[model samples]
Target chain A: MSGMSDKEDEKKSTKKDEAEIVEENGLVYVDYVGRTKEDGEIFDLTLEDVAKEEGIYNDEESYKPMLVAIGKNWLLPALEEELVGMEVGESKTVEVPPEDAAGPRDPDKIKLVSKRQLQKQGVSPRKGARVEVGRQKGIITNVLGRRVRVDFNSPLAGKTLVFDVTVKGIVSGEIDKINAVIKRRIPGLPEDKYDARIEGGTVFIELPKESRYIENVQYAEIGIARDTLKVIEEAEEVKIVITYERPEELKEEKETQEDEENEE
Target chain B: MSGMSDKEDEKKSTKKDEAEIVEENGLVYVDYVGRTKEDGEIFDLTLEDVAKEEGIYNDEESYKPMLVAIGKNWLLPALEEELVGMEVGESKTVEVPPEDAAGPRDPDKIKLVSKRQLQKQGVSPRKGARVEVGRQKGIITNVLGRRVRVDFNSPLAGKTLVFDVTVKGIVSGEIDKINAVIKRRIPGLPEDKYDARIEGGTVFIELPKESRYIENVQYAEIGIARDTLKVIEEAEEVKIVITYERPEELKEEKETQEDEENEE
Candidate 1:
């Protein structure tokens, strides 16, 4: 009887493991706290009050809760790898090293430019002058012999950063929003679908009847959607569906429809 | 000799503590990231690619790092509270409950409106649609009798969220930019500063002496200049120089000048 009970326990454990894996495939939601690794300064938070108080808003709207999927490079590789097995409603603290966080600062990034460049730009490069070139901004670290050294390395590089993160909810929804989010997150995916639905907390996407070779893409897209929705909803119960039809089947149906049109 | 060694150890410990504090202060810069705690999924890393990415720009500049004093409530209060005494180059994970994170879903924020109201505003609320109202976007959870129950609760409510955050850099110089960031981060500060600078990685602000009161309100204005300078090198630094000659002092000088004119 004891052995039987142990076997039952093993079965239960297996079931739980399967459920966890399935849950991982669903949408994920989370809350987080971020700080600079160098100074232990908090940079961002999802807390409503914090967002409001900090005024990180668009016309008074706080930064919306962010969403992403597993296995997609939407986040740093280190962060993505850590999120793989997280379940809905589960919270975890993961430490991302400098390489995984923002990468180490590179000395090569810092460049020195002549004062003539500053004069051409109509800027006075003082001992502590800062300037922008295109999208990059640099502070004048030293003004020596008409040359200004500017550091382009990320300020937070080579520092270990900490984050207190909570997986809040997962999203499993209609095809349009899901696809929109996916496209927004991963720009490389092609756009072609016939119908889509979310049922029993899962998303089902169908391909056009004339389409060919979609099984692998379907699985990958579904997995991506599942993980993204999980982060959006911060919930565990998300499902996805993908359907594809062959071109031969579509051609036959079209011929039949042409015959019917003639009969009519 | 033992006492001397003990004294030297004490000095070394203090030096280490000071270095840690300096590191913390030096690690100021800005980046953007999105994550959830419940699932540990990161959706975005604005800091890493802010300059490279094109879409997330405001006023033709990407959102870069801005400085916020620790415990200043410039960010989420919970997140700010978590950052105290954190050493530079170290990362840690913190968990913020719903109350501290996104706050409990507010039922009062949920409302039902007639379809006509949406039509009046040129909005179409479908069965499961999301709409924006006055800087707040709510999702349509249900529709009944021309009424739509839109949950104003953050899309991330009740879920643990994660943020792979790092203090990329501190807002050290550019008083105008620092002041602008401060105003955006913390309102109610006055705007009276005429000059702002960073020396030895510390922020220095100069105010118009004519203004009898120089309060935090000025911080926000200075922050704006600082931020603008961060993006535009040609932007000029603010300088407030008050040269006041009291009426009594000027009176004697003027009389003497008049006597000289009469003699001439």
Candidate 2:
């Protein structure tokens, strides 16, 4: 009986393997580390702990294995094309030229502004200082007397990029896909905190108490709803449930005050 | 039959009057015109057309008969006191002393700011011109050479006020009370567009398409829920539903594209 069951399990595993392979329009979770080829400095990564170890941890972001919807313009074209046809637990290293990445730098984007003007605007003119002149933001390359040279192009405009990416897994469950969409908006919180589920055609997301009062949280809710409609085609509506409970300290204090009144 | 029905209507009208009259905590819709007794110029009013005709129209505000919860501090303490024990369609003119209205002006609030500094900060300081010095906003009462005298006091300070108020009606229905809570947040949209209902313990509000993308709409939704909980005693949860539909113009275009695809 054990030998018969093992052969049946082998066939089921083979079917699952074929279905889990990456293709266009498939949802896959991946871990990636991207850096410039020129300096080999790590610029971007998916895993949070790795980002912290590399000293690139961003407080404004929550890092995790990203859910990439293939052929959705969610990643660089060169890198996205390389991800196709990869199986679960597969790894690939892709190199992208400047043209395919941030586009080649234009000489016209580099210009000189008055050093005295920068000082008046509270910008201390020094080499490699970041500043915004008028509307363009750039890095100050040189400060020579009254003249300061600035480059308004993308910081990686002229550099080739190297990305080492690993396919973590495929998100096939309906609930997992919904959580993936929720993570894209309320990204500061832990992935497990967002309680996302789908019932019939409506997607419901219960925001954690930590995110109930975040800045522009309503905007984030609207975004999650709109993005879910796009990512989950069968989802007809999204209901974001945000419950604002009275603080425990306040509740306990109120109860204490009432008890004192009762005693009186 | 006509005579008997008329008698029955009279008995029903008496019961309605007993229920509709304003008292402490009663939600009443009122129209009010407030002006300083010292200068008969209107300082505040409720009606939109009247406000526009009087040249007091504010683009940032929505004008309608205000929902006033008597004794809830929704108006001046003196004015709020006058609203209690009022009846629907009842009109009253109440006078308020300067002390009971805007507090008496303090001389310490009047001070001189440097005119040269104002000019340097791009403020052309002239007599009666509004200016903000540091964190205090004030009117320039006098501009003499380099010294500009600014009065950082309430505009209605030291002014005796008179208000001609009329109670339009009382909001007694559950839906109307819910609408009052919603209108407070989405004041820009017309009242007729909002569809609010109470189902079991949940209060559902289907937001108008016009309000789907308003500034801070999520904030507005949250406020509506919190306010409803406070105002509607039976509402255990508030569900604000915002639906974004494809624009009519785009829908037609997509239909045409689909028809062509079917033919192909």
Candidate 3:
């Protein structure tokens, strides 16, 4: 970005003098702890040590400052709305009503099924077992002698949520922001794995070797391009490169086979 | 390419004067009609109308001149080997032995199974019903009340094959040749859907919109890049772009929602 002209348009209603503030469509990294209002029970958080203490640590999850695109609903709508106008390193506590979060629990979504029918659908008729009916993931709350009750509402529904959130950083600059956008779409790999550059209005991305055989990467490619174009105004195009290079060992492995086939 | 220096390296044992001839790793297009030597049965051919006349038309196949990467085994090993050193418009009839085509029929491949066992494997015990056992596809030869006979050998394993092949053209020039490689990997889409270009040492591809939701496009991306690098020789890198643009209708649909969320 060339000095004055670029920053002026990106700035909107800045409360502090010469400080980057959050705005709609801005990419920001945040650390947050979400809890239910009824019991103040921590359900989700970004700190690994805290999760370990709370007995909610998952081996597969990478605990990092969550990246959120404001106005995109990556967070609860109420929480995201409160993030606007906040500056980097700012901390705030926000209360979200059930409507703005997971929505009020719908009694109509609950159903009772015959035990035989549940068994026929391959669902074990045991209490607390997870089940999916009509594409809704539900919990089998009760298993009577001949009938089972399932609740399809989301676990957090109908409960107000409270969050303690800190804006760690607001992503700036073209390429850094593009990398952030890429990390949002393809989260399996670290940001350092991808080499990104901008030249002649086109953004070039070199994907890491591990992504070459990943299934359905075309969706990630489309999402990356769309999100980059929507957030990074100057990026005219996004190009991703996935390379499969033969290592020296593989070259040696094919030599005997090459010697055997002179025609083909 | 620096004209004279490059052509001298690519040319290998050319038979004709100033005419580009096929060599090892060259890309060529061919039209062929494959027949069984036992009864001269028309089994496969590239021409669609001929397939219809012979009562073997298949709606799923795209009947175009077959693109073969010489020495890559896209065809039978003997057939691909014969493609080397051939020039455009040359026609030849080649006879292939059973061993070279599909391997000699194995006597041990014939097996008898109970009809109940075939039914358990979800195979109908009718004569000529296709069945797959232990990853080998076979056809049922006889069904006797409770006993069934299946031949695990390939249908053409014991027969000599004849192919009337004509070399239609050799794919030359970097861009045209790169498209061919792309088509070879992502066969479901047309070549024109991807706009490919080479700048500096990198090859850039713009994938079609329909490919975004395909189940396993990463495999194709890797295959295309590897094949291009191995066959094209000049490409040092490959970059692919997939774009998802919001149409005017979708933009109009979101305006009301945008107006409602000013904080986000």
Candidate 4:
């Protein structure tokens, strides 16, 4: 009887693994760390401790899992390809060449621009300053007496990238997919601030009182709706709900004052 | 016959003056210059040349006549009282006592706060910088070693103010009043960005495409609606219309490409 039970448990585990394998056009959540191939210097990471140890932790930002739609070109082509068939709890290191990454740097993209031109546009030219010079956006590589050298190449160009990607989990369920899309579009929001419910192919998002006046909230809503419809095939409508309330402290003080008045 | 016509014209002009006289609760527009009574130094002015001569010309801000709803406490009580019964295109100089203006400056309002406290609160205490310390808003008057002096008193307090006011025109008509309220709430918007039209009791405002995504536009809309109801008794509804468009340069380029394709 023990041997028969062990065989049945192994069969169930294999079935679960098959179900969790990443597929084309599947929505996946991942925690990733990106490093330069040459020196292995960490450029980006979603893990909090790894980011802090790399001296890039920002208290203002909340590190969370990133949502990726496979085969949609949301990520580097090579990286996305490698991520395919990755099961939940799987980790992989993908090496991407310069061309497959941000492309190789071109010397011809560097040009000399007059400092006065930048000043006229209210941009102060300084060495290592990122600025918009004419029609091209570039970083000021050098600032001279009357001219500045602006390099329009991508900062990570000419360098191969190595990404250590871990599939945290596969986001399944229509509601979870909606939440994942919202998380991707409007990241750094606390999980409790919004609640998502789906009924009859419609998604209703309840927004916290404090989030109604957030900057670019309308854009974020539109982005969430677009991405939700793209990922969740059953969702046909997305509605954002905002309920107004006085600030918490003010409301509490008012309630206390009213209680005192009633007692008197 | 010429003498008879001239006498009749004189009577007509007097009647016109009586009709155009400013009244209590009347909406009026004015162009004014505020100067220090002690030195006749211009402190503020709507006239470009006067502002230029005073070395206070700001190229970024648009200078235009200010709108006033008399008896609304929008202006200093003394100044508003003096403006009553003035005629259109008339100019007046009103001297307002300190008590009726910003009120007397209180020395007790000035206090020294530690620079470290300000820094800890992420407030940079620069000399002449306006900052909010605790619950009171104040200006930094001095920065000493380890301490900064903040004065909560108004900058114009303890001094009589002199205003050279000229009534540019009296605002009449429901449409004009609505426009004035919008201008008052959102000053410096170019005149062509929005067009307001009234139909029945509803006001339809066509907003520029660029303004639809502007920050605090919702708050501005609420303010305009509130002020319109207060000023224009006939208006009952304010509707904002937003239209989207491709950028002009991109649209033009697309059209040129289409033209080439059609030629082929």
What TM-score does chain A reach in every model?
0.53, 0.74, 0.75, 0.72
lDDT of each: 0.51, 0.75, 0.76, 0.73
Q: Write the per-residue lDDT of candidate 3 for residues A103-206, one digit (tens) a residue.
A: 99999978997888778888788999988776779999888779989999998999999999988777867777888878877887777788888787677777
Best by TM-score: 3
Please compute DockQ, using alpha carbons, for every candidate against the native two-chain complex.
0.01, 0.11, 0.24, 0.04
Docking class of 4: incorrect
- What value does the lDDT take at residue A105 in candidate 3? 98
Q: lDDT tens string, model 4, B1-264?
A: 111234544666745744367876678887889876877777677788878877889997668777787755667768888888997768999998889988999999999999988988898889998877778989999999999999999878788899999887777767777777877776656657878887886676655645546676656655676566555545555555443333354345445645765897
TM-score of 3: 0.66
Q: What is the C-alpha RMSD of each candidate to the true structure, in Å?
A: 38.4, 10.0, 9.6, 11.8
Q: Which candidate is the best by lDDT?
A: 3
Model 1, position A229, has a per-residue lDDT of 46
List model 2 lDDT by residue over A16-94, tens digit each. 5554577655677888999999999988888788888888889877576777876555788788878889877678999
Rank order (by TM-score, best first): 3, 2, 4, 1
Candidate 4 structure quality by residue, lDDT tens digits, A1-264: 111234544666745645467875678877899999989888777899888887889897678767787755667878888988987778999999999998999999999999999999898899888888657789999988899999999888899999999877676667777777777776758777778887786676765645546677656766676676566554555555543323354345445645765897
Error of 1 at B256 (Å): 92
Clash number for candidate 3: 0
Residues forming the 10-long window of minimal summed lDDT in candidate 2 chain B: B1-10
